[model samples]
Target: MTTTRLPLFPLNTVLFPGLVLPLNVFEPRYRALMADLLELPEDGPRPFGVVAIRDGHEVAPSAVGLPETGKPPELAAGSGFARDDPRRSFHEVGCVADASTIRERPDEEGYEVLATGTTRFRLVSVTAEGPYLTAEVEPLEEVAGEGAGALASGVLRAFRSYQKVLAGANERSLAPGQDLPDDPSVVSYLVAAATMLYTPDKQRLLQAKDTATRLAEELRILRQETAVIGKLPSVPGAEFTVRPTSLN
Candidate 1:
């Protein structure tokens, strides 16, 4: 696929396609970005990339190797740092999210916006355009059709089991099998993000290129979560509440 330039927001959390992320945007740059997005035509997919800043904070451009010209660092082909490297600046692959719903804070300080991931995009380069960072990116292709359904089903079942365990641990009830999308890619993303074990695990799932790979990774996480849950007391209390669905 031909690559295109996109505005980027480097965050601490990972976002997956089809998952909804609520962001508190307070910085002047992001406020401008949101304003520009609101002005764009909303007919097609209104998307932007969300990449996790690897080493330094996203709010500080100087930490991510912003050039003397005050431009965002370019992600060229020779860039050889691992995504998990603490020295690296950002993740190469990120999800494109549509800013579907937004509510501006009355104080005019920031906005509480709800964004839904629409597709995966790879960062080819990044440049500072005024306040926010922009990236050259390409859309990642979906998994092959032949095995998508099976992979998705496996992931859904695992997710169901995980949710059950979570509910049991917290003595809470969850409406299982509620309004899940039929698409395999979407299902994989939803399950992975919904059943969060750790940030790194979620990041791995988000970076997985295909449905099959993502399903396998999610199953592994579910098994690990189950094992950890098993070692704990069966008594229901706020202990299990430490890991809430809101974090996921």
Candidate 2:
């Protein structure tokens, strides 16, 4: 595999190939990252690696409290540098993303970025020598292993059941004429992204060895989730929650 260095953006969420990631870039370090990407040639893809934060907050605190002299305290809250060590702070597996649209905010304070996940990569090493994080990564290949197509068919049926359960529990109607893709790899990724699984489960799906393995896992997950949902009184409305990152 060819290894290359790419800028890293660690988030609290796991990204999968072909998923859309919209980021509100306001931090100075990340704003610099956007500026650097904008400087790249438009003809070339502006790619970066996005690894899930394994242990802490994605947005680090810039300061905690004022010192006795009324001066801003140094980064005391784990600081982004001290806490965000690549080897310890993030999952080794991640997805490479291509920035499709970048628009500067009218206030000129930040940027709104729309990026799409393109491929998977394994983080080899990381450094904070620069303003933002950068990593050496080896791209992971997507392979359709033996019996992928057959597994995909079963996964599709299981996914439909999963969706139905969610709709019933949430009192929402399913979209009419909805159909899933036939390609096993596409199905694997699509289901992985759509399912409301926790970050670790999503990471596990992203790290599956091949399409067949991913589909098999999805089949089991969908059935399990569907059964669990069926027993619940009612699925609560979605709301953001501060979940601790898991490294299992």
Candidate 3:
């Protein structure tokens, strides 16, 4: 796989492909990243890398203070102030997302946008020359000869179940006839990317390369959620705890 240099954003959350994540880009480094992206050529896919901050805060630097006493001496050389800075580094595995739609909010906090993930990439190296973080990335490809029909079918089934669960919980009617792609990879990508579950689960889906494996994982999650929903209370608006006598 060929490696490409991309702007990096280490966030507290993980983003999946086709998902709409609203981010507040008030931080100076990220603001610079967005500005740099806008300047890129319009024809090509302008991509960026997002990695979840595992140990430290993404907005600010770490609080380890100076070099530790018992730590490996070499670790201290590259490990103190740099660890605290958001722009200093990022995780290795990240997806390259296309900033499809962007709307600037009234204030300068940040722009709201929908990003679609196109490919999975691993961060090979990073350079901290400018305000934003930039890294060399290697794209991971899907397994060959994976049929689209089976994958799409599995994804569709899980998605339908997910929709049903959402409707049951929210007490809303299901939207009808949403068109899904026939290709398995596309289906898997879209469904996995658009889910509202926790970031770690989404990251797991993103990292799965084989179509069958991805579909299985998604199906498992769907079934678990469905089972959980079935066991929960059936009363609508029960979460609010309104008194029974107040309704009269």
TM-score of 3: 0.71
TM-score of each: 0.77, 0.84, 0.71
By TM-score, who's the top model here? 2
Worst 10 residues of 1 by lDDT: 77-86
Per model, state how many residue pairs clash: 1, 0, 2
Task: Report the C-alpha lDDT of model 1 over 149-190, residue by residue, as the tens digit.
Answer: 877777677667666666644433336758777787778777
lDDT of 2 by residue, 135-178 (tens): 99999999999999999999888877777666633432235258
Worst 10 residues of 3 by lDDT: 239-248
Error of 3 at 192 (Å): 1.8
- Leading candidate by lDDT: 2
Q: Model 3, residue 166: displacement in angstroms?
A: 2.3
* Candidate 2: residue pairs that collide: none
Report every candidate's CA lDDT: 0.66, 0.75, 0.59
lDDT of 1: 0.66
Error of 1 at 216 (Å): 1.4
The predicted structure with the larger lDDT, 1 or 3, is 1
